[model samples]
Structures are given as C-alpha cells and as structure tokens.
Target: MRANLKTANLKSGDLPGDVTHHPYDAYGLPLMVEPASPALAKDPLAVQSWFAEHHRTLEALLPTYGGVVLRGFAIPDTMAFNAMIQCYDTDPNGYAGGLTPRKNIAGKVFEASRVPADQKIILHQEMGYLPSFPKMVAFYCLKPSETGGCTTIGDMRRFQKQIPANLLDAVHERGVLYRRNYRAPGPVSDPLVALFRREWTDVLQVETVEQAEEACRAVGCEAVWEDDGSLSMRYRSSGFVNHSVTGEEVWFAQVQGMHFNQARLAQNYDTLNKAFPGGRPRPIEILFGDGGDIPEDMVTPLYDILDRLAVNLPYEHGDFMLLDNIYTAHGRQPFTGSRDVQVGLVF
Candidate 1:
C-alpha cells in the first residue's frame, strides 16, 4: 500500500487508483491485497469482516488505480449456487476456445462450475467486443493453478493515451475497417444487421457491406464498402453511457470500426476455424498496444504506455480481482500448468 495515500472504499477494504481520467484511461487501480491470517480466515465472523470492509475502501481507492486483486482470498464455494451452476454453461460460438460451458444463473447472470479448472483466461470486459459491453467485472478463484492463469490488464483510457492523436483523429474523421464473422450470433439481438441471412458467394452467411452499411445507418452512422467486399465505417454517435451510478462519460473508443486495426483484427481472428474440431474460437485479441496489425511507428511507444499502466497478476487458489469497466482492460499472460477458476460476473 502507498502509505498515507487515499483508497476507494468497496463493501470492505481499500482498493487502488485510476491512472488517467478523460473517460478513456481506466478509472481504478489493481490491488494485490495483503494476505490475512489463515486461522482468522476460517472464523466466520472474521470472514464476514474481510468482505464487509473492502468495498467502501476500494471505492475510495478506485479513483487511484486501474483495478484491484484481493490476493489469497479463498472461495469457500467449491460448487457455486444451483442457479449459478446451471447456466451460460454452453455457448458454442459466443466465447473463445477453452472456456467451460455452463448455464446462466438467470436470464443474464453467470452460473457456477463443478470441477477445479485451470487455464489462463483472456480479457475483454465480459462482452465489450462491439457495443454491448459490461460495466464492471470480478472473479474469485476456488482453486488456482499450482502453476499458471495470471491476469493481464490493459487500461484502454491509458491505452488511448498511447494511441497517437493522428490515429484518434483519423478514427473520429476518416473512420476504420471492422469485420465480424459470426456464423451464429448470440441470443442478444444485433442492433445493426439481422443475424440470419442468405449464404453469399462464399457459401456462408455473413454481414455484407450493404448490410453493415444498413446496420451503421440504424446506429446513426455511415458505412462504406471496400472493393474487396469488406465494410468500413465510423460513429459520431453518443448516448447516456454514464456508468449506471456515476453518469460519467465512459472512456471508450469513439465507435467500432476498421480504423483501429482491420487487417490485424481479421488476421488474428481465424473465422474459418479450419483446424479445431468443434470449430473453437481463438482468444480475444484487442490491441490498443501492438500484437498483430498495429502500424510500425505506433508499436514501441504504445506498448510502453500500456505496459506502464497495465498489470498482470497470476491467480491463486483463493484470490479475487475486481475491475472497474471505465478504467481498465485486461488479458491472459500465456502460461503452462493447472489454472482453474469459477466466475461470478456481478453487475
């Protein structure tokens, strides 16, 4: 802890900080919670004390760091609640490869897990891919890898700070390319194009340039088509996306488009799924920093900026990390070993 500095108060103790503010730099910092005593952890009253004290503390601390991790915090519920255990279990196409299939606890809630599962998980706030993203996210590990599954975070707001202004201006003005290849869309309806459509020349159902333009129009934006039959677009649109409680404008990309890294997004994403049997999706690849198609000039600086703000901490048998949606972006650190965890995506 940075002695004498302030903290965000959550339900229980102090959390961390916000590295930057213009709505794009993430708002909270990550806290590697100082571990409490083992014997006291077993005391029910003591357990209650830990949970109860952290929230308020973290809230005050949220303004300082990008997110926080309650290290060594045990998840007593090896088997989550029945409602949790049954749902969102199976989404054949919704998530990337290697996630356990489970049912939703409710219409839009998370279910629980049975076996101890361990594998490094990638990041993207719950569902922030296009537009329908989550506002806050957290995870509690009932069991951690004897070896891997560390968490990596990217503060998009901070990420944008590193994104050259010229690129930002281009996105705001010239727009970017965006290609989404989904054979089957999630139950959540698409705001722009109908998920079901005819098989085009490729013998596959895809959102064509025309359809993408129509979808863009629906969202009050314009779309253009490249000669190669790809879609290009931009958004000057705005809405009341203030955090449900804060009403503050979220620090996010102006809109979704190819401007960010179209070739790269398409490159990293293996839509054909030609290799995996069940046709597994690849891990989430969102680079405000550099990985795939980021331009040469932007690579070194962007990575440095991101590396400064983002933090990646491996999971433990009993650890919990809470993320403030407005401030941070997170991902997986490639690793090898048993890494099992159960999730509770609370609003």
Candidate 2:
C-alpha cells in the first residue's frame, strides 16, 4: 500500500476538523467528515477533483490517526442506488461477472435476511476468496437492527501482530485449500449482452462441485474427501506474485492467502434450516458451509484473532459502506422491524 493514499482537504465551514484541529486518519476509516452541505459534497463528475484535492492530506493524517468519519456526506437516494448497482459491476470478489450472481458465480439466495425478522448474524469477511482485494472499506446502514444489530469493527493489522511468522511461512510454502458446498442460481446473462475487460480471463460459468474441486486444485491444494459426501482440501493461499501497486512480495501466509478459503461450517447452513418453516432458507442457503482455517480446535483461536484484527463494523443508515472486496470480509446478522435497504455494487 502507498504510504499515503488520501489527500486532506480544507473545510468550508468551521467544524471540528478546521484548520486548528485537523482530524487524522490511519487506514481510511475516519475519512468521514461533515460537509458544509450536500451541495458542497463531491459530485460524481467532480468527485475526482475533490479526491485530488484531499487525497494527500487525508493519507498523511490517516497514519498517525486511525481513519475519518463524515456525517453529511451521505449520498442522495438516487445516487446511492446507482452506486450500489455499479458495485455489482465491479465483481470485487473476483467472481468473473459483476451483476450476474449464481449465473456467473456461485451464490445462494436467502429466502429471508434481516428485513423481516430479528436474526443474529455471525461475523465473517465478505468474499474472502480473492487475494489483493480492498484495503479501506465503507458501509452505509439504511436501517439498523431494532435491537442487537450493532456493527462491530475489528482491525486485521492488529490481528497480523498475533500470527506467528513460522505458521505464516508454512501456508506460503503450501497454499491453503478451501471447500464450499455453496451453490446459487445460474448467472444472469444478457441473452444479448456484450462485455469487455482490462485483461482476458476465463468467462465465469455456473459454479458446481466440479469448479469447487478445480478451485482447490488450481491453487495447488491437496484434495481430500469422505465417503459420506464431505470434502476437505488444502492449498497454498498465495501465488508467487507481487503486489501490482506496491511491487511487494505477496506472502502466502498473509491474510490474503487465508481469507475466503473458509471451511464454511455445514452447521451454519443446518441452523438456517430450523429457522425456515420448510427446513430451509433461500438466500441463507446460498452461503452454506463454514470456511475458515479448520481443525475444529484451532478454529476459534484463529478467528478470535481474525475478529479483533479485521474492521467488522455494524451497519447503519446513510452508510454507503464500501470495502476492499478482496481484503475485508463482511456478513450480516439477522434483524427485525420495518427495515428497507438498497444494496449497490460498483467496480
């Protein structure tokens, strides 16, 4: 990562981050600042200019501080909607296509999420599958859970502090292999759709047991299976590559390597079955299985550290949250009440 990625900007209105006490940000969290008004807020067209104005100062201030947080910068409803749909286009998870879900990638559609009922969501990183994903992420909570839907933030840099270098080196030598029985509807293809990319890669097709196997094998993972129809695999979490931006060594044992290879707990799915009247939940089913480093005994200990290190904040209204799709992981806990939220995805 660049030593400084955000440039600081001067405030138009007298506020806390005025010339006297400029706020600081470390990993881009506290970047949120109260704009004088929505009009002064950065427009998409002028957004680039606004960024250019502040990126340097923000980056410099962030290191000594943690991050920044702005209140009035909440995007308009129309703009928010557009941004989220665009998020779908970005395909941050490296799932091939951005908009197409199971059709282009493998994802389950849950019949129910927090919109209708109060549910407890477990904490996990989103799309922990890809390696060089996102660094600083954001979240805009349209509606918070009525009761216990409090978002938590965990710092992964801190988590890295606890990981033993030797253990990290081991995964680097032999990649981490992940197995998921996860499946979702086929990709949403444009019967008359044409697309282009910066680089040429395989056109992602429907996810299947075969791809699951290939996902493991492609990463040089050793596969294992049980007669009763269970899979266990291990692979090197990293490839011999360099950070495209920083030209840094992509270490295998790093979080990028360990992420997304979650041994998705089959129990997580089974629990959803009981929650649903028909013994199954649609979207919840999309995300079946538990995927994290396994060995049962070692699971909690590792996650305990992962939980503390990663930025795992709860959702809130006006929070157009974004994250490094590859680096940060996110999941939702069940919620209740008359809650409505729009999810926008952009590249």
Candidate 3:
C-alpha cells in the first residue's frame, strides 16, 4: 500500500504515517515534507520510489501551495537528485541564453547560480524574460552553508494582487519588453563589468554572431549587433501570465530583478550607470513593449511587495524542492560558508 500524506498547519511534531506535512509559515507558502518512518528516511531508493508513486498528488499540491519541499531524504549527491527528477519529468530544459552563469553537474542538474556568495539575487521567475521557459524547476541541496544562504521564494499570485490596480492596468495595456546585452570575450577595463556580464558566444553556445542570431530568432527574440562588438536581444511578453493550473493571472516578468535598483546592484547604481554607454544601459533593460520607459512609480512599489512577501527557505543537505515556475519566484540570500545547490528544470 502507498504511504498516505496529510496536510496541516501545525508546529513541528511527529506523524503516525510514513510522511509528515508542515507549513513553513502562516501563508503556507511552501509545503514541507519529511519521512516519518526510519526505514523510509534511511533508504534513498525508497524515498525516490515514494516520490514517483505520489507524483500525481504532488502535482496537485503545487497548484495550491506553489512549492513543495522534501527534506531529510537519503539522496546522496547531484547524480541522485537528477535521477529523482527524471522519475517525475523525463524532458529536462537546456539553459541556453540563461542570465546567470551555471555549471552542469550531473545529467540535467546544474549549479544553482555562480553569483558571488556575498550578493543577494532578488526574487525572479526562472527564464522570465524568455518567450519559452521552464514549466517547473527543482533544486537539490547537496550541502548547506554554515550561515545564511536560504533559497528565497515569493508567491507570484500574492505579488500580482499587491500591485496597484493602475500599474496592473498599464502593464496589461502596454505589455513588458526586455532587452539583454551580450559582449564578446575580451579584456575588460573594469573587472566589475566583467563579473556581471557574460560573453555572447558562451551564452548561446555558438561561435559566431550568425549562429547566435539564429538561436535568438528561434526563441522569438530579435538580435541586433552593436557597433561596439556587443549584441542586444529584445523580447516582448506579457507582464502577467495565467497560471497553468490555477488560471489566475500572476506577475511573471524579470523587471524588478533585472532593474539597476535590484537589491545587490542598488548601491552601485550610479557607478554602474557611468560604466556603460547612455549612462544607464546595464546588461539588461526592462521597458514597455512599445519601447517606452516603465514608470518609476510602477517599478518602485513592486520591490516593496516582493520584500513584504519574501520568505527565506533555508536549505539542508539532501533537501529537495520543487516549484511551479508559473506560480512562484525564487532568489538567493547572501551566505558565509560554502553552499552547493544543484538545480534542474523541465519545460
């Protein structure tokens, strides 16, 4: 017989079954699960098989909770995590034209993000700027830092409702446009600029501009070559998208995270403005679909909403989290010691 699972809003305590469910917070933002049986917790294969057996229930849970965390599992490393993800989703997404730098670890798993440990990556949906993106994303914590380094998450549905009605009306009317700049590998005068940006060849996994343009076009983006050996790719998408399961229009853009006023780069805003041409052409730009500036008023309140709703989901060794990409947004908090979180996505 399958191990039964029950949901509740209670403090940490033992359940009578093989699995226990707990809410991380008041909003029940991420439903947390752990093995209640010693045998289930000791055997990795049993945990994996349990996940496979309850895949449908888990799928149903995600639409309501947005995210699910399976902690205290016996999975050993990145390879085991990849195998477990394969049990749920066979088709893994390729990270082409991805913003953050990552290294492929196992079959479909990759380093969560190579952003420096000191910087906070603000909450944003995975591949939100792209036309086609992952439908679901999963993270496996091979190791946790000694301090901090929580995987921050926010409910997009809440974020959407928080936005002022006027701003939502404007976004619905104008849509959102995103632009990304890519430069070729070369000696950069500023080390800071190099640290934030990546080369076009590396991002597209192609050697020539022609190949890069082709790749960009395939993904519904328009690529333009700059006079200064740089590439600009533009895409237009709705600021809000309907949640696949809930049918609720959820906030689903990268504007807040890509903006210069982002948590990590806000302090260097002026200096970064001076680093690039036009005084404000950061690596990425978010604008109205018609190439107009998104009003400052609209952008400012969003950060506040995200900050108010942000919940840091602390990591532990062998903890696995699955998120519905359309319903949730995720980020990274600053850390002290080493942290290894491998991630995988399915389109």
Candidate 4:
C-alpha cells in the first residue's frame, strides 16, 4: 500500500516499503498523514503495521510538532482507534481517579469530558495537577459538531516564553496548590450535585472514607473528611515541568481553570452566585504553594497569552490527533449540535 506521511516543511524521505513522506506547513502544528492507496482502508492489520513502522518517527516528531493528525484512514470506531493507538503505546492508561466525568467506551478508550457543550473548557494538560500523568493523549473524532465546536490546543513552550517574568519566577519558586472539595452524592434532582460531575465516592472509587483517604494519599494528595460528608483534597506541584523529551520548562499547571477570577471560571461563578445569593466558596480553588491567593494581575496576562497562542482544531469525522501532553495543552470550544470525541491516554 502507498502511504504518504507529511512532516511540516520537511522533504519527503525514502523509507522501507511503500511509505513516503511529504512536506507540509512550516509551523508543524499538526503534521497530517494519509494513505496513498484506498485499498489500505479495508486492511486493519496492514494499517496497524504501516503505523508501527513509523512509530519512532512519530515519537521523535511529536515534541517538535506538538501534535499530529492522521486523516483519511477510515478509523471506523472506538475499537479501531484503540488498536491504532496500541501501535504507539502498547498499554494505554485507564482513567481512574480522573477529575472529569467520562464513560469508558472500550478498553482504555473513554468518552471525552462530559461538560456542557456551551461551556468552554480552559486549556490544560491532561492530569497536570496530579503527581503522575499520561505522556500522550489521543483524540478520535467520531462525529463533528454542526458549529463552533473545536478542540483548542496551546503550546506550553511558547506560553512559557511569553508569560511575564515575575509570574514565572513566583510559580517556579513557590509552586501551585490545588484545592478540590467533592461533596457526597445527592439526589439527581439537586442542581448543585449535578454541577459537580463526581462525588467523593466516584472520584475515590471506594465505599468508605478510609479507603478514599488511602486512594488520595497514594496520589500524593492530602485528604480530609468534612463534617458534612464532603471530601477535601489538596495537592501541590510546580506550575512548570521540564518537557520529557525537549527538556524545555513548560507551563504545566491548571491555573487557568483553577483560578477563581479567570475568564474560564467566570460563567461557573456567575451560576454559583445566582444559586447561592450570599456567595459560597468555589468547589475548586487554586493558590500559591504556601496557600496564598493567586493575584489577578498574574492571571489576567496569562489568560491573554493563552488566548493569543491557542490553536482551534476543527474536527472532522474519522480524524485522530495524538498530542505530547507535556508540551501541549488542550481545551474545548463552545459548540452546538452533535459532537462525539473519544480519548485514550498513554502513560
């Protein structure tokens, strides 16, 4: 089968068998790959083999490109996508103790975050707050939205360079602390409980508070059981991480989503204010490692930098994107109509 692979602005190279590389854009935001022969679509084994041959190439290019989009291969369903990802990551990681509420669609394949379509999710690296996280994240688009829905990506390396020097120094020196409170599951009719996608039970995946605390401790989070059956979890980590491959320090925290005054949380805060007129503390908050509030002055410019550098990737059915989670952060845009994106994480 003829396989045409393109790296951004790089010339085609001779490879074993029928595979060929083609030059694309200079930025390499998403180097696209496609099969030259249509017959390859029907042979899953051949497709898998072809991708396996180029696995090292993809890994080497991922840090430089930030991401890669494979198109026109006719990845029929989640099962097919799962097989494809296995070529790169033999054992993809499962979503356990994950913050987002997602259903497992197949082995290691999960439905993307279950947030309201109208709400924009702030750009964040997957599981960035946790001590350990996936090295790569793959998204397979099953269906495309009618309008506005696009997976947004930002280069953390670029964000790191452009961010204010003082803020960078502060975060690097003091780190970031994330505070999350998971309330006990309430009746389905309760709007407040509905807003919190998962309860302490679901998040901890255990029946009793003791087990929950143990699970939290395993992940390096300090947990406390509240008087009202709520669970409070606190963890601290640096805002920047050295890219596993590039060794460049990248902005790696969830400050955009965790900070109270950021635009990303403005809608949630407005809803919360209307629900509780007296104003209640947010279910999640971010602070300095020493527990001081993050200054709005720091957050405002960070938000602006993310906005300026964000790349909105419009989805098409059967498209698959694999991202280097360390150097790239992903988010969702407000959308209308039906959209289905499945995700698989690689450790």
Per-model C-alpha lDDT, please? 0.41, 0.37, 0.78, 0.74
The candidate that achieves the highest TM-score relative to the unseen native structure: 3
> In candidate 4, which residue pairs clash?
none
Task: Report residue 180 deviation for candidate 1 (angstroms).
Answer: 2.7
Per-residue error (Å), model 1, residue 52: 4.7
Worst 10 residues of 3 by lDDT: 1-10
Where model 2 places Cα greater than 4 Å from the true spot, the runs are 1-29, 41-69, 81-89, 92-125, 131-138, 164-166, 182-236, 239-294, 307-316, 324-334, 338-347
lDDT: the better of candidates 3 and 4:
3
Rank all candidate structures by their lDDT, best first, as comma-separated numbers.
3, 4, 1, 2
Error of 2 at 207 (Å): 10
On residues 1-347, what C-alpha lDDT tens digit does candidate 3 reach at each position?
A: 01123332212332336788988979887989888877667888887777777655665677667788988878888777887887544233367778877868878788888888988888999888988877778988988998889999988888888888877888789888898898877778888678666788888778987899898987778998877788888899988787655556777878787755534367777777677645444588888888888766667888778889999988889999988888889998899998998898766
> What TM-score would candidate 4 get against the native?
0.87
Candidate 1 vs 2: which has more TM-score: 1
TM-score of each: 0.53, 0.51, 0.91, 0.87
Better of 1 and 4 by lDDT: 4
Worst 10 residues of 1 by lDDT: 196-205
Candidate 4: tens digits of C-alpha lDDT, residues 1-347: 01113432222343334433432345557666666656555666676677677665666667667777777776877788888876544222245467777878887788999889988887889988778787888899999899977888888878878878878889988999987878876666667656753587887678887888888877778887677677878889987777666556778878877777736556566776454333333467778898888887888777888888788878888888888898888999999999999998887
Candidate 1's residue-wise lDDT over 100-126, tens digit each? 344443333343322233323333344
Q: How accurate is candidate 4 locally (lDDT)?
A: 0.74
* Ranking of predictions according to TM-score: 3, 4, 1, 2
